[model samples]
Target chain A: MRISMDLELQDRPGQLKHVLTPISDLGGNIASIVHHHDKKTFRNTVPVSVIFDIEEQTLEELQEGLEKNGVAIVRIGKMRLRARTHILLIGHIIHTNLRETIDEIDGTGFAEVQDLSLSMPAIDGPSSAVITIMATGDEELKKSIGILRQIAERKDLLFIEPLDERGSPGGVSNEE
Target chain B: MRNSQSTLTLSIIGFGAVGQGVATIVQNVPHIKVVAIADSKGVARMPDLNDVLARKRGGQPIANSNLTALDVIRTIDHDVVVEVTPTNIQGGEPGLTHVREALKNKRNVVTSNKGPLVAAFDELTQLAYTNGVALRYEATVGGAMPIVNLIRDTLAGARVLDIRGVLNGTCNYILTRMAEEALDYDQVLSEAQDMGIAEADPTYDVAGIDTACKVIILANAFFGRHATFADVDVTGIDRITQDALQLARQRGFAVKLVGDVQELTVSPKLIPIAHPLNVSGTLNAASILTDTAGEITVAGKGAGSIETASAILSDVLSLMRDRT
Candidate 1:
């Protein structure tokens, strides 16, 4: 699982390394570490936000190790929906039950609709919509797109997907 | 000009815009000679190039010989047959027959038609190989864009993993106009038709069938996939609204009718505004993903009389070079 933790580090040399060593020692892959050098906490300690991927069972050990090292743990939370994509749909979007269309993706448990912008030119004409979907990972995002594709097919809507910037579909390449 | 030792004789089987373009270019080249030109009306054998063009421009038939296109293919002694016939995706007729006859006679064939290729890619390629003749169709896909030859000749060592691009200029023009002018699909389509950028019956280009045919050719040519028109999952740009285009533009994307060779799908895809494939107007762009070369993209006029003729001329010259 991916975790984002806010740690209050002392404004001293080797303090940032002291917090990162425990994460590395716990077999955690640190994704990012943002140091708040200018914005120090009220306690006069530099606040740093660290995000990493680690096993769920190792969470308590990491917290204990950081606490033992005198690092103040401000907050820790699981970072879900790491992958995001925007898809466009045309042709009677609302008339075909837009709520159910969004529900199909959100009910996947691994994905959710983050935002939507709709436009209807006329009362009797077709409508267009762009929905932003957020998923836990790339694979989950593909699955959510598959679910939406089927819904669009069933509802007789034209589904338009964005071409991934990686120069291939589904954000996966056959590079050796 | 390098192979100026012996003149290369060519029988242009289709006397449409592409055929006339070939004739216009061949007039200045001393090493290339057009022996026969054929349109739907009739065939002109050993005809004067200037007279043929003048007659064609005057809306008159250039039929001087009783021989048909098939007859010329069998009887005429030519090094290459330039088949620029209109595409018939369903049956691949006329062009298919012309191509088969030309290859069976052990003559090299160059074509801008996609019908015969989409209908019988494997059979035509195998026929060409077995007969020890070349079958080049650079003009078939992306007009003058050097895709088929670029992968086959220049990028010979590099393995092409996939190709994605805007294959249809008419569709691209429509989409670009729709997005840029904030006009609806119908409005831009009409404007395109009036400007002669689109045909009167723009179903083939607008409905994504033309792009699908190009994808099938690319899949068959590069990926070794025996794909057909039915193999593609196509979605045209007819339903794309101006509002959707605006929304995509607001998100820093330009909607284009992109053809994916690997996926064998031709649909309106959201391309980043800054991306190379986000080419506007009647321009065609292709991004080739390769192993050694990474990503190589080429963009040019996707459809035009002279642009398509340039590709056809290159293929003919390549055949000439191969012979020498």
Candidate 2:
């Protein structure tokens, strides 16, 4: 599989060479690197984009090996399935089993609720949550949404799914 | 060595061993001063730090002021608050509230307690960022091993793929004893208790809750994952038999209470005897996996008053540098 990872490297001599040695050791072929020399991250680190290809199972070990050597893998390329999209759930979020709601989607392995932000106005008022979910492809994303829709229906919560190319009147952002 | 120009008036909450350790070390340092100290009884505001040290060393009580530590943080003129309170896993009390108040009041915070971070990491980190103050806890996971600062400061640019460590000193001590002397679990527990290495209850350390908490903290700090103790799959070393250790040793491996963030597990695992995580005795070690650097492992004394205090001291210095 062709994979790309956005890595932040220390701006020091020989740092880039130190990071590339691992990919070679893991039997991966490097495609290209987009080094951000002019730009520094908020943490004062240099960001380097590396694209490579390796066997599928070796990906896990490659990630673990990289982190063990003090290299920070900030963002992995298509590490999950396809990409991530955000959806909003309105009404009594806390009153419902929010934990279970998130866990069931995550349990699928194909999709996970990667991020969440909830706004609870009052004790009696309904709460709203923006949950970011990741899936491998468009089909899996739709399937995951279907599963979440059923969950929202059972709990009587409002599930505002992501918008398509048509862009409905009430549309959620399709990040992917 | 007083730098009155850059002096940071500091207060310490929870005047326990770790707090007292920080208090004693900061007396000789120039850039910081202990303006307030609080114990379970009450807080004592600016009582000649030397006298407070003497009283604590002599097992004497320092006179309490009318105000509590929380009140002192709000009312006093301090630049930073050092929180070394005991761990309360359930609600993350006292330490959680203390850290929140310090950040909200716009004071830099350095803490050794894992409870608050384990309980509400994103909330506290976001609070610190919003308040424009440093919330540092170097002593939380690996005690004096410099785990947090190693990732945050030294390895700034490295994208940490995952972190694996033997975080709890008490568990490491017990496991080391079992492997070295062919001792049983119960025997090592009592010996550790007698030596003051393990607590009398030993549940927190023995049952892998402490390691799990450290793993959760690493998950939050490094991976930006909002993980709790419940998220860690824990398996303590209390169940490891001497036979198992001998078998592992014979197989060129050592039984270790390994904490891994990628796996989200704090369980007794078999590590090769040659591995960096095979640290013995009270020593703690952390291995960071990154794409660029391969594997960088750090090992040091995981817990102690003076040791943990040193980590906090560096945090205070880091906060001071950021202001300049």
Candidate 3:
């Protein structure tokens, strides 16, 4: 997966290395990088976009990782920026402990539930919402979704269609 | 204290996937430290894991901290260097710079990057010889498989007649997927890229430059001939269609991006036949034909963090066995 990191840090010596340390330090394989060196006259922060490729599973925790080092990762899309996927599960996720379910989804390293939104109804009513999972590419997403659907079916939960988010079934960027 | 287990120093100029893998591997290997790790941009050194932490997760980067490649070179008084970068087309980067720097610093080198190896093999080999050091590269030809070592050691006594096989996993993967799934060229290639089997800018693999690089490594070792990437014929999998892949499979064969180097001619073959490589997924296989050994076929995981690391580890072990 190729992640885009936007950093707001002082333009100081060894700062780029500081921002990059966590990425390299965490064993992420850098792909192509787009570094906008043009100084931002507005703030002392250097706005840079560091793009790199990493395993799908490692990325979910990557943003949280960058912010810890003070890189200021403004955004990390759950759709999986480069070569991963996003899935949504709607049901009584909180009752199931969504975090644990996500952990189970991601434990395979092939897929992970990136984010979730749950809507709980009155005390005896059914609960429902959504879970956005970022899995490894399409085939992996299928495999992961297959597992999730199985889990959902067993638990009487719901898995929605991934039509709108991802494009033509011929596959993403088929022509490079 | 000329040498300390904690201060092992090694410098890596090409800080790409393979380079990162090298650094990660060296970090896990105790008694070594990465003092300097350089890429095309610049360099940095993390003496220990604590020196750098992850920001995204607000925890720690899951990387090895004991030794950055540079620390191994500068501090631990590294006995060897490992270079892993891309192969240069007209010219390469940290691949060449790293190889030269390590050799000039009197350090043995083990690189998987064929760019520097093919472009400046003679110079780097001579530099190592002049310095009385061993510049070994076991990961050059086949990413995870030990084709280099197989040639340099296993078949050392065999009269190698020719070397050929699907050396490029990306092309092989594209072709294989096209055949099985009946996918178009573009579709399969995209999937391969997303799967991390194909390069982002897949010019090298699709253009047969990757096969050419492997052929150079094989030719130099087997034929004792100076070979260049340009010397080989280039036919990328890009031009290959599902029709081609289908024709291959229908004929009871799997189409492979074969790098054939025998008697000095490097050619690429899209063979559709029932080969061992008919085995599914991103595995790499190589066949070395020798007079004494007839033919040997080996296949295994060709890429990834730990797999590439295993190749460098073998080279390090080789160096360890011969201290003098």
Candidate 4:
């Protein structure tokens, strides 16, 4: 039930409270928080890490609430789904239309986006990103990708199929 | 032994006279409900498109003036479809079209449409197999008689030699009169039509085409062989006159358009016999010549609205039982 999130937080004391407030009000139990901010060390803003426990459904509600609160997720990890899939979501992704894209994965009832590695070329528009979705099974992982493929088919986006080409469903790749 | 339970959600296509006959049995089959009924005129479910038409291969599109059988199937969520529509033997359009749609949508089917059995039997059977479902057509032949099931299951181990019978009751009735009351073929034919046994265009029954279709159906079920209607050597009793009937009576026999199919390439002849079919009129008699039992003949009322419907119910019961 513990969710680990890596986020970019403003370098201010109560700014941490601002990010944590939405998650806490969403009924998540905050276990610990670590803030690392040094303009000379990393970047302009601080990268804060959060660890909290939540019921399975609340974890989903928390994710939705945080995303709605404009919380940019750098990474998230949970024990629910035993397998994780990394996918590259390519296109005008800065215009990312995050809700629409995430809805495609959520619609399959098999996977959830756990971690996002994003590259914003500018502050204004199009970007590219990688998404790590945790799913219950390998089939569920492919189903998540298939949903993304449909979105890619309809949009100007490109869904790079995972190089971890599953030869068959139910066979977990031994490649760590 | 509770022969009743809950209602069977049934979707019916082509709500004609034969379709009503099926619905009557559904009402009586312990616990059964007719969820939907469809026809060219209209579909008796929640209204949808005013008319939906689909053009099928090698045939004109069939028009559904209102809610489609497919729509009723989706909305009502029927478990089975009873397709009793008039058949398109050559094209197998609307009948097979609806059946395929139902099966793909995960609904079982039972029907007596000769065209689907004749042309698309293989495809339909495969679909039922893939879907883990059943498609039965006991009313398709020997209406109300268990001939197909009997030969397919009971007499499975036995080698069957031939199937010879008065398959068309209308033709049998005509020939029976020609043999007995000293009536001519045309005279008996008119009487048979008046009795509602023969169609106004009695070509199917009179010309032995009906018998041919039936025997091909029997052959497929009985021997596990694919025999088309054209494969059966057909000869009608239309030519049997009063003189022939009299001569047959003199020889202690009867003149029946008796559809006969055997192992050899054969023809239907005026096969002389001492069979007591002379007394059996307006009745159906079919015989299965087998290796073990010799020739076992079963004769009874084979064709009528009620009787055909009863056969349909039996098939439905069998399907339900097997499903459980």
Better of 1 and 2 by DockQ: 1
Order of candidate numbers by lDDT, starting with the best: 1, 2, 4, 3
Stretches of model 1 off by over 4 angstroms after superposition: A6-28, A33-49, A54-74, A167-176, B1-5
User: What tens digits encode model 1's per-residue C-alpha lDDT throughout B1-324?
Assistant: 222359998899998899999999889877788889999989999989999999999999899989999998998888899999999998899899999999999888999999999999999999999999999999999999899999999999999999999999999999999999999898999999999999999999999999999999999999999998878999999989999999888777789999999999998988778788989999999999999999999999999999999999999999888887
| Model 3 stretches astray by more than 4 angstroms | A1-176, B1-9, B40-42, B50-77, B263-272, B277-279
The models' CA-based lDDT, in order, is 0.90, 0.80, 0.63, 0.65
Preferred candidate (DockQ higher): 1 or 3: 1
Docking class of 3: incorrect
Q: Residue B144 in candidate 2 has what lDDT?
A: 84
Considering only chain B, report the TM-score of each candidate against the true chain B: 0.98, 0.97, 0.85, 0.85
What's the residue-level lDDT of B311 in candidate 2? 94
TM-scores for all candidates: the values are: 0.89, 0.65, 0.57, 0.57
Report the error of model 1 at residue B17, Å: 0.8
For residues B1-324, write the lDDT of model 2, one tens digit per residue: 113457888889988899889988988898677888988877887778888888888988775687887897787878888998999999799899999998898888899999999999999999999998888989898888988999987888888888888888999999899989988778999999999999989999999999999999888888877898778888777756565566556545676788888778877665656676789999999888877777799999999999999999999888777767
**Better by lDDT, candidate 3 or 1:** 1
What are the per-residue Cα lDDT tens digits for candidate 4 across A1-176? 55778887655556666668877787777877887654313545677788776666776677676666656677888744756655554457656476787877876666788776665545664454656677765566777777776776577564543222213322223121
The Cα error of candidate 3 at residue B292, in Å, is 1.1
How much does each candidate deviate at the interface, measured as C-alpha RMSD after superposition? 2.5, 22.4, 20.6, 38.8
Badly placed stretches (over 4 Å) of model 4 are: A1-176, B1-6, B46-65, B73-76, B263-268, B271-273, B276-279
Docking outcome class, model 1 = acceptable
